[model samples]
Target: MRKLYVIGIGAGDPDQVTMQAVKAMRRAEAFFVIGKGDQKRELVEVRTAILAEHVEGPARVIEIADPPRDRAPADYTEVVRDWHERRAELLEAAFDQVEGTGAILVWGDPALYDSTLRMVEHVLARGRSAFDYEVIPGVTSVAALAARHRMVLHRIGEPVHVTTGRRLREEGLGEGSTVVMLDGDCSFTEVPGDDVRIWWGAYLGMPDETLIEGPLREVEKEIVTRRAELRAAKGWIMDIYLLRAAEVRHAES
Candidate 1:
């Protein structure tokens, strides 16, 4: 059986590539680069840079175009499931073509919001491709946000709820702090609280990185404007933010 290594290349920074990830990259004969369209061309360049800097031996890069996904579906879960099946088909076809060790470089940690691991497993479940694979964890964007801001994710011993923008809108903020990802709508604006503070970062770990931190009411408009400008300038943007009541703000101020 051939082997596959699903490595996390970290969020937006080539330096975030771990030693373990480097070793895996060196061992692989080919890497599968998932395409996120032309708007995110910078992300692909970042992966290429990582391979160039670390991989001592020769490695082949296989670009795989991602299947189309419904941007606004009434049934999100079902739509995602169908999209994953299509993606698994593509991955299986690519894996079948490769004879030696292959890899897939995922952004952030695979265990987080990413769907690569699930797609890999789906391909295996079909009994079409058999390959032993290992996971190499990397720094998540959440970590990058905290490190860049020099702030903790939550207040003293409080639990942090990591969720998506959709959920944050539907469920409201939980106890402690809320770290929101996959939010295209700047859902923080709809979070329904004036006393909250937001620590937001966009293009984290990249040259165009931007950060905003202040009371929600004071900085919400600024964040919205900056986010739109950044997105328009770059053609794409990925951002994450932490939201909680202004307890910490009150204490510090």
Candidate 2:
């Protein structure tokens, strides 16, 4: 049976790739990379950089275009499920043409909000079982962000909540510790600036990365403009941030 190695190549910088992930890339017979259309070509470029830098053996790199998600709002869950099925079909077709150990380089850690693992599971459930798979963990952007800001993600006895920007906007910031990811818009504005402190980082682990922290009300505008400018210049951006209620610190004191 062919082996499938799903390696997390970290968020952006090539150096962030774990030694184990690098070994897997070199050992694999084939590498399958996901291309997110023309707009997000940088995603594939990052993966290619890792291959060029790490893979030394006779491994072939194949590019597979990711299927666009259906955005029409007719039952969000169903739309996502259907989209995953389509993606699985494309992956299966690519797998059919390749043999030996196949590898995929995932952005950030596969365990942290990444869909590559779920897609692999979908492939297995489709009754096309011919390979054994393993996931190699990578350094997550959240960890990098926190390190850059020099802040602990959670208090010793407090709960830490991980959520997306959309939920942060719709549901508002939760009371306990919270970390937000995949937030394109300035969702931090949704929370009352007076009551929270934010530690934010963008393009983390990359050379041009930026970090900003302070009471939200004081730095919110600056972060918004800086993020917009950075995104416009790079054509893409990945960011993560932490928000804590002011009361939490007061209670600890």
Candidate 3:
């Protein structure tokens, strides 16, 4: 039987990695990092930096190219399912080759809208399981964004709704809830500017970080411009934000 630990390396910064995550990495026999093509090579590089800084045991780091998603059809859900299946297959093969503790470094906390947990579940569903899998949580980008902006994501008694950029664009911002994790797409423009305030941060916890906070209508253009500039400069960016209605804050007070 083999043991596997799925550790969250947090968003961008190596210092954001939890001590438990580091302990897991140091104990693992092999570390597996996912590479999402060249555009996101920094993702793998960040994980490598953490390993180099913390891992003390004799562990081998392995980098695997993530399978391509069929995005041409634009069926997001279907494409993601296919991609997860392919990833699970690759992970299973890697596990078979390595004995002792195997580790997979995940971005941000595993439980917070991350798919690594789901992929691990898929591996377990195969019923050929011989590994005791564990998940180590880390600081989420949402937390980092909130802290960087010095804003409370949710007001007292008001719910905070964490959603993706697509949902924000499609359904618009929800009433009395704070929306976090808008991955690109400038979805903030969909909200009625008069009603909401946006605290947006790109590359949170990194040196190239950019943060903009103001009424959505006022800062929408600024956020868009800055995001575009940062992305173009670095070839990539990972951003998250919190959108809260002005009324929600006043009501809580």
| C-alpha RMSD values across all candidates | 2.6, 2.1, 2.5
Please, what is the TM-score per model? 0.96, 0.92, 0.92
Task: Report the Cα lDDT for candidate 2.
Answer: 0.84
Considering summed lDDT, which 10 consecutive residues are worst modelled in model 3? 244-253
Model 3 lDDT per residue over 1-253, tens place: 7899989887778899888988898889898888888998877877877888998744598787888876445788888887888888778777887878899999888889877877877788887667889989888888888788887777767777889888887777776666657466887787776867888888877778888888888888988998888889889888888887767334565
Query: Candidate 1, which segments miss by more than 4 Å at Cα?
Result: 248-253
State the TM-score for model 3.
0.92
Candidate 2 Cα misplacement greater than 4 A, ranges: 57-59, 71-74, 249-253
Which candidate number would show the highest TM-score if scored against the true structure? 1
Give the CA lDDT, 0 to 100, for residue 227 in model 1: 95
Please estimate how well model 1 matches the true structure, expressed as its whole-model Cα lDDT. Answer: 0.92
Q: After superposition, how far is residue 12 of candidate 3 from its true place, in Å?
A: 2.0
lDDT of 1 by residue, 25-84 (tens): 988998999998998888888998889899875558888899999989999999999999
lDDT of each: 0.92, 0.84, 0.81
Clashing pairs in 2: none
- Stretches of candidate 3 off by over 4 Å are 57-59, 72-74, 248-253
Better of 1 and 2 by lDDT: 1
Steric clash count of candidate 1: 0
